[model samples]
Target chain A: MTEKEIQVREKQEVQQAGEPTKPERYFVPPVDIYETDEDVTVLADMPGVAKDGVEVRLEDDTLTIKGTKGGNGGEGERVLLREFESGHYLRRFTIAEIIDQAKIEATMVDGVLTLKLPKVEPAKPRKIVVQGG
Target chain B: MAIIRFTDRPLFRNPWADFERMRREFDALFQGLTGEYPRQVGGTVYPALNISEDADHLYVRAEIPGVKAADLDISVEGDTLTISGERATGPAEQRFSYHRREIECGRFSRAITLPTRVNPDQVGAGFVNGVLTIILPKAETAKPRKIEIKTQ
Candidate 1:
């Protein structure tokens, strides 16, 4: 075999190795995190997401937020200027020990999903009372 | 005989000043009314508002989606505050083939006249996510004060 043929064979192997076996499309929702004394709020911009269309599920140690876009049953030929197309979003976050799994609350309003996670009572600071000696 | 379409104008009218006064009243009523959000955008309408109190500081929050930090313009004058930004749709050819478009793309300006005077020297603005939050501290005299009560 010629040296050029060996080089071509090596290049083919490298290209095959780089290609993913089962490619999965992932969507990352833009999130804004804010912390106050009471709890930490996470506001995620999930446009075109409806309450019934969204699926918030927790499995094992991963929390997933999935949703379908444009479910309003409006079908027509219309011109679109700018598009924000997020199809079947599936975002998973590894659950941390600091998060209160049982008390997690999620609400969807105006295509914005807000998740309120209250910290555990033991994790919060408590004011100590001083007694007069 | 030819029939002419009768265009009946007002028989009697008030003077120019009286008409101006009525127009002002109508304008005030329209200005006080709450405006409805544009239905084309899928998200909620975040109106840029500047709020101030006689006793405390002021805080302003503006809803600007699909707008980057570079597109914002904020200015303050005395108690008047203004926020202007543009949400461009980019090149026309690039946007012509979009499948679904929900976000609004255009120029938006919101001007608010604060109820109470604020300290112009201490004004701060920050943008996070798509919300623009502006903090304005109150002047020394405008802040809340506690007066001592004497017991005789």
Candidate 2:
């Protein structure tokens, strides 16, 4: 009726984009990478992703993270204004050789992926003791 | 003979405008929200979100990671919907200095005005993993209806 009414709502409903046309969309999860005394921890914000749907791989010096989140939408549900489009999360970081890849640990809680990259023995911080005079 | 200095920094290249530098800057945009939740939009906070509406319901979904469900508090009054929660910053153990901290963790609250009227009594929400979904069904009178034309 009025411009205000039309402005509030979208003119038309947006149909869900199905595969066979456009490829899957990937979003890089927000991440915090910091190194501690003994480990390099990376916290990635990946909401809507389940623990089992996530995959972490370390090959060579590259560490890759992939997660597929489900349950953003349902069948027969017409989307009017789409914002949080559901899809896959992909991010890869080039790691240094000093990291102990074998000891890398990953934990997912409340959609955040916590990756702990333990440092090698030589890379860990070692305090030197001074002899008393 | 004059000695030439080997500098990896490109000559005339402004560090501020570099692609990687710009991205890193963009990532840090939300780092300003490392405190209590403020009551303003674009204040730059964690967990980007999307609010959309359909004929029968208005939907709001927010990206919240590493936050427990119990820590989240969602409420709706009138046309305003608010999602407030806290995300633990890091591991309990004290770690080393931060090489780079991009992800924001702390108190965050987002209160937005809905595009249409909804029944507060019929509001439904779901928190799975880290995504919080709020489904507010439109009031009966809010839904649009089709009118028929009669033949002579």
Candidate 2 stretches with Cα past 4 Å from truth are A1-22, A74-86, A123-133, B1-47, B92-94, B146-152
iRMS for all predictions?
19.9, 10.8
Any runs in candidate 1 off by more than 4 Å, and if so which? A1-133, B1-55, B91-96
Task: Residues B1-152, candidate 1: write the lDDT tens digits.
Answer: 97755665355644585776687567546643533111233322234232323235566644454467687888889888887766654334332333223334566665667656778888888765454667778777777789899999
Query: Candidate 1 chain B: worst 10 consecutive residues by lDDT?
Result: B36-45
The TM-score values for the models, in the order shown, are 0.38, 0.65
Task: Tell me the tens digit of each residue's lDDT in model 2 across B7-117.
Answer: 855678666567865764564354435421222333243345566666788877776667788888988898898887766656664656665675665677667777777
- List DockQ, one per candidate, in order: 0.01, 0.25
lDDT digits (tens) for residues A1-133 of candidate 1: 1111100000001111232333222355655554555565555556446667677766766767765554322123121211122234456666543556688899876556777767666656779999999
Model 1 lDDT, residue B8, Cα:
54
* Candidate 1 positional error at B7, Å: 50
Please give the lDDT score at residue A133 for candidate 1: 100
TM-score: which candidate is best? 2
